[model samples]
Target: MSLKRRLELLEKKANYLDSGVKIPQDFKKFNELIGLPISKIPPFKELPIFGYEMDIISNIETHRDYALNKARGIGATEIILRWILFRAVQNKIPGRKFLIVTGIRLGLARDHIKRMINLCYNIPGIIKQSSQYNITINNSEVIAIPANPAAIRGYENVEVIFADEAAHWDLLDDDPVLEAIEPHRTKSNAHVIVVSTPNGRRGFFAKIFHNSESKYYKDVKPWIISEGLLIDRVEVEKVQKEDYYRFEQEYNCQFLTVRYAAFPPEVLAILQSNSMEYQLSD
Candidate 1:
């Protein structure tokens, strides 16, 4: 409103115009460098990417066998979903096939796809096409299958497998699934991302966490994420009395059974089988 303020604003606009900021070609550089929140852009503005979220994205970019064990509502699926969109606009991705194991069923995973499509709806140059079990982008394809309640086995030609909630999955020994995922590692430098809260301490997810030190896998925990303001210390303290061990597993990323737990780790392991008894590959 004032003359001085108007002059300062004009100078700022002129300085911005004069600034020589090249548009980055690489997605990582683009993301880390100059990519602003969708809200910064008019007409299609959305939310900003948080620090912890960006760290997860970085992990996805850098690691071949990355594992994430984080609390609920912490945004694991979201960061990856956004990353997929970024890749879709990249002209081509590093791999052709992307598989998402829901650890429950394709039905449970359905919401994820819906949200993904919605997120990309206003973004230019990115298109999402879905079939019964697969979603295809420009040069990349994403498929989702279940690991429990019913087994969906025989994953073939998979370049990346996003194993969601691996702790809840039924395949304890991980026969067919491991066979499918591990082979792709050496074959394609394919990334296998195992994400979950601790169900107990006797499954494929447990193995991944315990072997976090191994070269075969890289582990990421929520505490390592700065700007983790979403975690309220008071809320965590309040929930401790209700279910302490489960809380630790879910929030602290510990692999332990809950006190007075209905399904103990042993029973869970007993019901779980190594072999994929019913192979339903799509």
Candidate 2:
């Protein structure tokens, strides 16, 4: 299918999921379907990404055939959680499924799922627990499973797939989770979202983000704060005084001249907590 048509289908599915419409036999098990209101769904507080809105509406409005390579604490997790919750409350397929793969295991997975539920319930009429292992807003269906690639063989046709901390996911030798989830994509017009900070110098996430040749590589967006943008003028001089050029690059996301830089120059530039205290008290 053309990417545009695929994106249109994706947008329709997202709208259906968000509005809490029941899936018909073509997309569900039965003929009749229902509708749920947006107020009854979980609400997400949008945050700044490179100073732009989180793009949840746009992200949900189309099929995400791409991945997100983001800095840590950049609101990637929060948005993905919102999308998964949307599906959980309104899935149409029999045994309609949503899966989250983290670097952690079952106990942690359950904890994360509970946190999502709390976020959903915290929003008032948007979400409520229909039963254990089931969350509903306007009859959406969502379940977050802690998965290791080796153990993820049985689940099929997952409607939404999220890979968290994906930079660390490559350490697993038998990552069947990726394999298991691929078939579901064509069938469900599946939405796959992967988010992580750079882990090593390179890996799956890195290759996809850095190298355009990878099959999964679609669109790449990088967010960087230019040097001197966040740093105080006084502190910039202090980093120069300390000769910590390497410390500055990592945090500031600047190009570095240092070899094997553990602490890039940009970070060192911003490391002047003592000076801030000195200024505050003075």
Candidate 3:
């Protein structure tokens, strides 16, 4: 039988058996049901869930809006994609939407959608249709697009939105991408998930992570030398010696002073202090 015919039969079977099928509420259970692929190598292996990953998932389950300031090479992205796929498949509401907004490029966003599709391959009747930018599963849809304000404003009924590499989003116009998402997310009451490594001491990601008043449940995980979860301690120490700034910003999760700035933060602070004293002397 053709792939189209096979899908038709699966849909028919799903419609008949849907009432009895139990969707797991816990993400771990759902993940076990459709095992997570560990590698891109053939005869793919199942990913063992890590303690930190489970902590991130627990935060996701508890909080509607979450921000993660993560170090490089952690499995934050993989965990999030699996959770999104789980949500897309289990959603019963018709025409509900999920979105992934990637930094600057539509192609990167589409790649995320593709990963979601790959996750669906083992399961039957979940994926109805898939393209580069969109996937239709049952009555719900998951879409991927660039972090462009005009493009973002066009989506509605969005149940969840993932802002990937959020710190690197173009801030030429003071982050209109986030500005655009705010109204849409507010109107839809959608869960907003922002994940990125530290870019600098700027952008929406940095602001939310630092702001205690922000609603996002923030989680920050750097390279734990004792645990050595994702990155090795020797490699981290090597980088720390080679490029201290890079180590601080990327691995230590510190929002360092922007490299291209005219003066260091201390110099600027001194200048401001001198000007204040000069005004008082006048």
Top TM-score: which candidate number? 3
Q: Over 4 Å off in model 2, which ranges?
A: 1-53, 105-108, 122-141, 170-176, 215-282
C-alpha lDDT (0 to 100) for residue 158 of candidate 1 = 54
Weakest 10 consecutive residues of candidate 1 by summed lDDT? 32-41
How are the candidates ranked when ordered by TM-score, highest leading? 3, 1, 2
Best by lDDT: 3
Q: Count backbone clashes in candidate 1.
A: 1
Model 3 — TM-score against the truth?
A: 0.84
Give the alpha-carbon lDDT of every model.
0.62, 0.50, 0.79
Summarize candidate 2's per-residue lDDT along 165-193 as a digit string, tens digits.
66655464423455655665677766777
Model 1 residue 56 distance off true place after TM-score fit, in angstroms: 1.9
Where's the lowest-lDDT run of ten residues in candidate 2?
A: 27-36
Candidate 1 off by > 4 Å: 1-47, 91-95, 148-157, 223-228, 261-282
Candidate 1, lDDT over the whole model: 0.62
Which scores better on lDDT, 2 or 3?
3
- lDDT, ranked from best to worst: 3, 1, 2
CA shift at 163, candidate 2, in angstroms? 0.5
